[model samples]
Target: MRPKQVFVANHTSMIDFIILEQMTAFAAIMQKHPGWVGLLQTTILESLGCIWFNRTEVKDRVDASRKFREHAHGDDNNPLLIFSEGTCVNNEYIVMFKKSAFEIDVSVCPVAIKYNKIFVDAFWNSRKQSFTMHLLQLMTSWAVVCDVWYLEPQTIKPDETSIEFAERLMISHRAGLKMVPWDGYLKHSRATIL
Candidate 1:
C-alpha cells in the first residue's frame, strides 16, 4: 500500500486513462482498495460507482471531494490514482491543469507513460489524426515504450490545480522530451469524458 492516494501520469494517450476506466471510476484507476473513491469523469453518464467529478466538479463538486476523502481516509481497499491534468492535449508539452487531484493532502506518486513514435506523433491535433485512423494503427502495430518513472512520493499541498500539478510532475520528464497532447491516450480509451 503506497498510500490512500496515488498521483499518476497525464499520458498523451487518452486511451491510457480510458483503459483505466474499465478498471475504476477514475478511468486511470485499476482498483479501488475496497473503500470510498473519487475519480474524475472525462466522459459523462458513466455509472463508475465512485465519486464522479466533472472537469473539477462538472459532475458535482460537493460529492466528488467528500466521497474521495471518505474513501481515502477510510478503510480503503485501494489507493486513489488521479490524473491531475484533467484534459488530454496533443502538444509536446503538458498543458494547464486542474487542482482537484491535488486537493487531497496526501502523497503523490508520479508515473510517466512512454509511447511508440508512431503513437506519439499520432496524438492528433487536426482531422487527420482522429480516433478512427489512430485505433486502426494501434490495432495493426505494436506500441513503443518510454520509461515510466515512479518517483518517490511527494507531500501534496491542497492549493494546486490539475494543470499546476501536471507541470510539477513534468519535472521528471527526460530532458528535451517535448510534450504532446493528451489525445494519444484517448485513442485507446472508450471515449473522452470531458
Candidate 2:
C-alpha cells in the first residue's frame, strides 16, 4: 500500500466503487444521492471506508476533502480512491475530473476499467432505473467482465498546478483504456464547490 497515493478512476457504475475497493483494498469517496439510494448506500458503504459526500454542495465537498486528508495523511492504512468524474459514463468517453481529488499534493495512480456488456449491461443508470432494479438486472446476467488496469504513479511536477496535473492524469487514463482521445472538457463546472 503506497501511503500518500490517491487512486483516480473513471466512474462507470455504482458497482465501480465496490469493485475498486475489492481490487485495491482502498477506501472510496462516494457522492451522496437522495432517496433510498443514498440511505441504502450510506448504510452499506460507510463501514467500508467510504466517505459520503454531496458533490454539488461546496461545504460537503470541503468537509469530505478534509476527511480525506485526515484519513490519507494520518495513521489510517487505506489509501484514498476517488472516482473523479463525479458521475458514471458509459466508459466510451472520458469526462472532466473533479479537482477535489487533484487538490491533494500526492502521487496520483490512474486506474482504467472497461466492461464487456455481452452478458449484461453493467452500466447503472440511476436516473432511469432504481438501484434494486439495476441489481436484479445484474443478478440475471451470467457474469460481469471488466478489465482493470493500474498505470504508473504520477507525481505532481514542481511547477504544475493541481488542475494541470489532474488533466494530465485524465489523459493518461483515457489512453490506458484505449479510448478516443478526449481533451477533458466538462460540460458543467462545479466552480462553486471548488
Give the winner by TM-score. Answer: 2
User: By how many angstroms RMSD does model 2 differ from the true structure?
Assistant: 4.9
> What are the root-mean-square deviations of the candidates from the true structure over C-alphas?
8.8, 4.9
Clashes of 2: 0
My TM-score estimates for the predictions, one after another, are 0.59, 0.81
**lDDT per residue (tens digit) for residues 1-194 in model 1:** 44466556654654655444444454233222222222224234234434454533343655666766666655443556665555555535564445555666666666655545653453544346755567666667665344455566766447766556556665336423465444333544675589
Assess the local accuracy of residue 144 in candidate 1 as a C-alpha lDDT between 0 and 100: 36
Model 2: residue 147 alpha-carbon error in angstroms? 0.3
Q: Return the lDDT, model 2, position 44.
A: 73
Report how far off residue 70 is in candidate 1 (Å). 2.7
Q: Judge candidate 1 against the unseen true structure and give its global Cα lDDT, from 0 to 1.
A: 0.51
Q: Which stretches of candidate 1 lie over 4 Å from their true place?
A: 18-51, 54-59, 118-126, 157-194
TM-score of 2: 0.81
- Candidate 2: list runs displaced more than 4 Å: 34-36, 170-194
